[model samples]
Target: MASSTASQQPAQVWDESQCVAALAQLERLQAQIDDLRLTIPRVVAPLSPQITKRPELFAAFKKAAVGSQSNIKAFRTTWQSQETQALFEHTKASLEANSDLTPGAQLPRYGWEQKEIRDRDAEARRRDGAKDGEDKAVVSMSKEERERILQEFRAANGQLKVFSKDDDRDILIHFISGGLKYRFHVVVNSETNGGEHLDAECLGNGEPFVSITRCVSLRPHANELKPLLDMIAAYKNVQSNSCAKCGKLLDKSALVPTARRSKQPEEANEKQETVWEALHESCLD
Candidate 1:
């Protein structure tokens, strides 16, 4: 009975490889958490007087502060015992000795897979899941619903000059930010099945939009578009003030990055996603 019990105990599976990978991932993530804790509030605190005019923007900064606290809480749950590394080593040895394993046995899954691996899986799933659902949603949304959503967008920007000819199926929002008037259109259903953006002319009498591709937002409900508007302002800032490649206020050409677009890093979000900032064109290489 003693021998049988000892044999059964070794059956518990373990992988030192996963343990090692998890530690490496945690170290990288902890560095990001540290950076956010120190930098976010310092950067935004001076803007307190500015954002108060729009309470929602102030609230956003508060939300970010709470998120930083949450990341601190999460670190407490990482490796509960100091013996975790030693335990993983011991457990793996036992698992290796249990030579009774089958040739094609399935391994239990944990959500700690690397971000790139998960991204590939997510992309494949998104492609497979794509269909005419967005189009159908446009048909179902009522004019009343569209009006309510637009009203929420305008509530924060009283100077907004909103117009659209998409039969309540899309939106055109014109608002002032940084003392300059700018506008963008949202297609309730993107691709409009090959139609142009809700807006006719874009910045600088440019054609359509900042991007050649379609971008759409189908929200779960009507909410203030403060975040979206903030994104637009940040985009303008990068274009006019900073070099994306070097993250300097000005580049060698004495110009802000002419390029635009922001991508999330794998180390992003120990709590919530970090803000997307502007970039330089040649940095793409």
Candidate 2:
């Protein structure tokens, strides 16, 4: 308990300037220590995912992530500040440093090569997951299981109202977002559909929901109802992120919230997920 309490202390924020200053102080302290022929236990860099087992450690990381603007994704591109770039470089360097380079196994380079390697790794993971997914394939669900899942799903969301419960496999639901009611037809996978997944389509939008579709078929997930929830949340995000100026969820280009407008523009850029007015890039003019 004493060691646990000691380890969970709030981290000191090490901005670039602070890091430089600390290293300078450490140099002077090391000289003094050498003069006295004394030594002290150095700070060991943490390699554990359990570094954030305590709430304080988690909050500290959250603070650093927010401070660096590393958590922000704009137009599906990550906002990598200098601090985050340094962190990325250090992470790759650390892996190379620790790895046993037997003969010619090179660490992935930061370019198209890295991306290709990652893509290959992702494909391999998908193939592995597909074999595992066979066990929990939506086609294997019994009528009672399907009905119960749909009922629990309907109960979970206030926006989704059941339009029809006729087919146990096909669930038709009505959702309200941006003051517009949208109907969705959800079909759990079966042999007819090539098995192992479920997906939805907005009756009004005519094949929208890129995120949910990707999530349902591509992403490896254990929860069966996550894609359904994602479907609702996607519309909810569209509702909450209406263009402040034009009062529309989508621009004339039919893009939903690719930009943001805040009273404090610097804060909007610097901070993570601020209470900024969401907008489409076309509406900025």
Candidate 3:
């Protein structure tokens, strides 16, 4: 019984020679196959059949397309007046009915407010305000009003030149007297000067022109006004500006403001708070 069992078991053979022979046969077969492939003419693949449409099928398709198009065309005019409008109203009503809350029903709010859209709207408002002559030192005046004011000033000052800068944020006046150019700016509040309307203070005909001492004297003597013009040109065009009273570098903050002479003859005597001079606070002290 033990011998029969041992004979039934398969024998494990370790033959290197047979394995080498099998590998040689495989290599030879592969080489012959490769050579045979090279010797044979390459078979060109046949072109696919061009799918020509059948006359009857095409005709049927055209008929169907024409019928569909005609049907659409027939409804096009009346669709807006009848079906489309009715459907739109029905949809709107349905949406409203669904959206409306019942007596005791609560709906969870999920969406957030669009901040980007809000920011864009705010920016647009700011730009509109700026374009409408808001926050300028010179008040917002109509073209007619501006012309009237200019004519009034020109009549008294004798052809004064006016220039606007910083999108008309600042208005510069050049008074040509004694063969000298006396430059001055229309008065605007230094604090919050470029901010919106400066709280509406610059909404009307802006404050009167303020003087920078000696730039425009009651009398335009060449000797007195010419040197002052030179100093003003230097002060404005260049950085360094010294106080007239004290030869120290004048700081914009340290400068004290005094009422400027009014351009309006009617308002000359009235107590004006327009800043005419920029003097050292220490000098005032």
The regions of model 2 sitting more than 4 angstroms off are 1-139, 192-196, 205-223, 237-254, 257-285
True-structure lDDT of candidate 1: 0.45
TM-score, per-candidate, Cα-based: 0.30, 0.33, 0.20
Clashes of each: 1, 0, 1
Segments of candidate 1 deviating more than 4 angstroms: 1-145, 158-160, 165-167, 176-180, 186-201, 206-230, 233-245, 249-255, 258-276
Write one digit per residue (lDDT tens) for candidate 1, span 1-285.
123334435444445444435544555455656665665666467466566666777677777767767666665544443444445444555565665555215322222334224334434543543443334333234557556656665674466666756665555656555465666655544344452223222344311132211121211121223344434434444334455457686443233343344445456566654345544432323
Enumerate residue pairs that collide in model 3: 135-197
- Cand. 3 TM to true fold: 0.20
Prediction RMSDs, each to the true structure:
22.1, 22.4, 36.6
User: Comparing 1 and 2 by TM-score, which wins?
Assistant: 2
For candidate 2, write residues 224-256 as lDDT tens digits: 654454444454543357777788886543556
Model 3 error, position 20 (Å): 96
Better of 1 and 2 by lDDT: 2
Q: Compared with the true structure, what per-residue lDDT tens digits does model 3 show for residues 1-285? A: 123223322233324333233334334344444544432222111111332456755565556556555545544544444434443444344444455446213311211122222223444654665455443344333445444554554454445565644444345656543344555654323334422221111111211122233122221221222222332333233222345445565333333222122122246656752222333322432
Error of 2 at 255 (Å): 1.2
Residue 3 C-alpha lDDT in model 1? 36
